[model samples]
Every structure is written in C-alpha cells, then in structure tokens.
Target: MAYAEEYAPTTADPARIGYALVPLLDYFEGKTLMYVRGATCRGYVEWRTSMVRANHANARTEARRTRTVSSATARKELGVLSAAIGFWHREHGPLESVPVVTLPAKPEPKPDVLDRSEMARLLGGALGFYQLEWCDLETRQLHRTLKRDHSAINRHTARFIVIGRYTANRPGATMKLRWMPNTVGGWPDFKRELLYRKGSEVVESKKRQPSVRLGRAALAHFRRWKAIDDRAREDLARRTDGMATSFLCVVHWGGEPIKDIGKSFVTALDFAGLPRHYTPHVLRHTRVTWWVEAGLSLEEVADAAGMTTQMVEEVYWHRSPHFQKRAAEA
Candidate 1:
C-alpha cells in the first residue's frame, strides 16, 4: 500500500496503468523474494513473466489519471523489478523456473466524510457526554486543555468545531489564533483585527488561498465570545491593574495559558468510541458538502469558503451526495 501510494501518482493518465497495484517487495518489507517452487523449473519463469507484463500494462493505463511524474515513478519501479528478475533467472536457471504472483492495485484516495445527520450526532455527543460543553461554550476552550476539566474539555471541542465549520483552516491556524488573542480583540469589528485575515485567509496557508466566511450562526457565536471576553477583561481590570494580557479563557489555578487541546480532542474521541478518522479537517469537508447541498452556486460557495470556484468544483463536489441530483437539475 505504501509503495503504491508513493509511486502511483507519477503519471498524468493513470487509468491506463493501475497505480494501486502493490508489488510483492512492498508486502515483504525488507525480506528477500523467494522462489517457492525452485524445484520445478519450466512453469515458474513463464508465469512470473506473464504476471509482470500484465502488471505493467495495467499500471500504464491507470497512470493516465495520475500525473506524468507518478507514471514515471511506476515505470522506474517496473524497471527495477525487471532487472532483479533477470538477474535472479540468469543466476538460478531459465525464466521457466520462477513462480507467478499477482500484486494488489492501490486504492484511489477519497475524502472521508460524515453525512449531515451523522455530523450533528457526533457534535451532540461531544457537547454532552463526550467532554466538550454544549456548543455554546467559550470558543477559546477548543484549544486549551491544561486541567482536563469539563470546562476545558467542552472548550476544546467548540474550538475544533469552529475550525471545522467556518474555515478550512488547519489545526495550526487555530493554534496561531490562540497564541495571539489580540488578533481577534474587536468583537464584531473584524475590520480592526489587522493581525487576522478578513475571511479564509486567517486559516488557509496553502499556496492557493481560498475565500471563506462564517455563517450567521458561526458569526453570532464569535460575537458572543467577544462579548464574554470583554466582560472578563473588565472584571480582571477592576480586581487589579498589575494583570498582564490575561487570556479570555484561563484555569482557576491562575491565569496561566492552557495547553494541549489537540491531544485532548483525540482523547475525547476515544472516550466516545468514535472512529479514529474524526479529525478537525473532516469537519471542514462536511461544511463544504453542506453548502453544496444547500444549493449555493459553486462560485458563491467558493467565495464564502475563501477558495477558487474551480477547486470546489473539482475536489469537493463528490463529497456531497446530492451532487448528481444538483448537476442533473443544472
């Protein structure tokens, strides 16, 4: 699987050559290849030769969908295999003496997604019994998990959910936001937040930046969070003037910053008996699908999500189950 994944994307037209095919060398790890029926000379070579030829042909066809580089990689692998087989046959005996073995094709990579209902259920579970407070918890708690208390747990969940839904931002972007709270200082007043990007730019670090925006619910949530934060600062200022840039979310022990929300997210998932595939990015995929299903124009969705319309049309269209129905209507 690793070998195929590593080598399959080299070509532009991979369908002619199946990149998903796994070589015996891959499964063996570092083990040497064996001639199981070295005793029987004639049948082995022909079978091995036929298998190798067929494998190459299949690989060539599949490589069409992939890049030229990936196809080249598969070809190079075949060359190595051919050279090795030739050496083995020459040293031992005729080509007829080797055994035949088939390789498995590499499976096409696809986005793993949860349907809207499943996503709602997953979020609900996280809100109550899982660990995170209901979605209404302070947005910052999503990243802070120093004490592992209920507040910390709920907060961490909310942060991740926000990352998943509003922006296609990676976990690192969330970390960046948490590290620089002032970036989001002006509640509702995004214009003043010069440190942060207007929309998806805050999250997208990819070479090609996408446009992203928060939905009404998401925007309202952040507005409320800002209000709470302002109130916390006011309370702190009243108590003492010596306080430093105290965080909006802090532990009872002291105003120390919480750390390790990502790990806690994983821990909460395990506690809930959910599949290991539950990552923050998966939620982003879910949101994109939701928008597409809701009948947003591809360009509109892309603008809202801070992405090129082409990208949304190409990569994410399949994630929505309603894509076919929508396309047919169009």
Candidate 2:
C-alpha cells in the first residue's frame, strides 16, 4: 500500500509530525507506509490509548473513532499498537523485545429490555408522528389537486423506532437503511445485508459484516414509508432531484436523511412514558429477550441479532416460562 506522500512523516524528515500520533494513524485509518517510533517503542499501549482520548476532540463534533476510551477502546487501541509494533519489529530490528500489552477483561453488564407492550407504544408513537406530519403536509398542500385519504401516512422517526425493535440491529446500523428495490434480478431492497464499507478501511470492532432483516410488520411499514417518499419525490422533484435514495429514516415530509435522531428517539421514549435510560440500544436487548422467551437457542438469537452467543447469554439470557416448561418436559 502506497502512503500519501504529502501527509506521511519519515525518520530522515524531522517535521515534529504534530501529535506524535500522525504516523500510527496511517496504520489505523489504512493510509500506509508511515514511520511511528520513540514513545511507541517504550510505552505504546498507554500512549496509544491516551492519544486516542486526547487527540480526537477538536476535529469532529461526533462519530469520532476514539471519543469514548473505555476498556473495549483500550482493546482496539492496543490491538493496533501490537500490530504496528510487530510489523516494525519484523521489518527492522530496532527494539530487543516487544513489551506485552494487556487487554481489559470483557464486560458483562445486565441489559435493559423492553416488554412487548412498550414496543407497541413506541411503534404507535412513531405512527402518530407519521400521521401528524402527514396532516401538516395536507394542510399546506390542501389546494393542490390530489386525492385525500385519512388512512395515508408517512412516518420516519416512528419507523426507525419500530424497525429497531424488531430487526435487533444497532441504532447506527438500522440508520444505514437504503431504498434498494426488488428488481427482476434481485430480492427486496431491505434484507440482512452487509453494512457498506469503503476502500481498505476496516471495522475496528468485531462488527463482522453485520446483517439485519426487517420483520413482516417492519417491512410493511417500510413499504408505506417508501410510498410516502415516492410521492414526495413527485411533489418536491425540483428541490430533491439527486437527493433520493434508499435512506429509510428521512426527515418527515422530505428527502433528507436523519443522521442524528437522538432527540426524536428520546422524545418518543418520553412520550411513550418510558424511562430515559431506555435508549435505542435497549430495542436490541428487548428483541434478544423476546427471542429467548420464544424459546430460541442462544446461537439462534445471536445470529439474528448480529452479536455473539456469549453476549446473548451473558447479558440477555433469562429463563422464560416457555423455556422453563420446555426444560421440564425434556
């Protein structure tokens, strides 16, 4: 892999190189062929983690690679450190021996889960938002020559809430939903598909080609939302010509993608009379619990949820009546 000549630093070239992390970033971000040494050789693990926590604050407002430096953060940071040091050691024998880097123990915390009734309230809230938006649009475009139906709805935030509940996808993953259609050559656009990645960049976590499938209810709602987007395309064609794609959760009554739906999510949860601690992630937990209660094995629930069986067992495993009955029968 060729390095970006302008950005890369070398030993012969003593240019301060800014944060001392500029060299290692090429390795982490897949730039290639940059020399990082000195403190890295002596205390790489600590330096790497500290650099991650301290360095990335100014550049981005959100979605930073190292915003939260937890133990898992340490694991990935140290993993990269190990890889870089190992590579350097093999290519050029500078250090006598590589110091051992210890990774943090895996965390096992109890998951907060939503019951089915709470799930319904969340979906109902989304549908209500859809209807509210549709009504607002109808009031604005009332004189326009179009047939009106009370049943017609186009909700985005609510769909996200409902889909997240059933798909067991991480909130971020579900937000990556697109509008791929079921053409003659292919299946329905939304299925358990690989999360899109660019170039040689890698997922730092074990997010191994995470896949999420919409259930029948979520699929139905998704189709309705697409229809709403299609109608929106015709009406707002001049403004949104190149803007349309398969983004499932769009801003209400428009073609814009909803990147940060935290406010809306919180609003929905609050409106549904749920706790603030019941974050979007709890949807996945709720799904896992439902799967276990429905008597699915840990492996089955893990595969469906795009997580490990160990994670499923550790955090979400609970013996429901069905599982207990089945156990007694056996």
Report, for every candidate in turn, its global Cα lDDT versus the true structure.
0.48, 0.54
Query: Listing every candidate in turn, what is its Cα RMSD in Å to the true structure after a full C-alpha superposition?
Result: 16.2, 11.5
Off by over 4 Å in 2: 1-99, 124-154, 181-205, 210-213, 238-253, 320-330
Question: Over the stretch 233-330, how does candidate 2's per-residue lDDT look in tens digits?
Answer: 66665566765443333334356666556666766665555776567778877877888888888787887777787777777675554445667788
Q: How would you encode candidate 1's per-residue C-alpha lDDT over 1-330 as one tens digit per residue? A: 322233323322222224223442542346444643333222323333334343235444565323222333443444444434554566555666554433223334355666755565455445544434334366544442212335534554655566566555434334334323343211123444222322322222232333245556766666666666667767788788755466444211133354445455655555454675466567766777778777777877786565677778887766555578756888
TM-score of each: 0.48, 0.57
Model 1 deviation from native, Cα RMSD in Å = 16.2
Backbone atom clashes (below 3 Å) for every candidate: 57, 3
Off by over 4 Å in 1: 1-109, 125-152, 178-211, 248-260, 319-330
Candidate 1: 10-residue stretch with minimal lDDT: 198-207
| lDDT over C-alpha atoms for residue 153 of model 2 | 34
Q: What is the lDDT of residue 249 in candidate 1?
A: 41
> How far out, in Å, is residue 168 in model 1?
3.6
Residue 118 C-alpha lDDT in model 1: 59
Candidate 2, run of 10 with poorest lDDT: 8-17
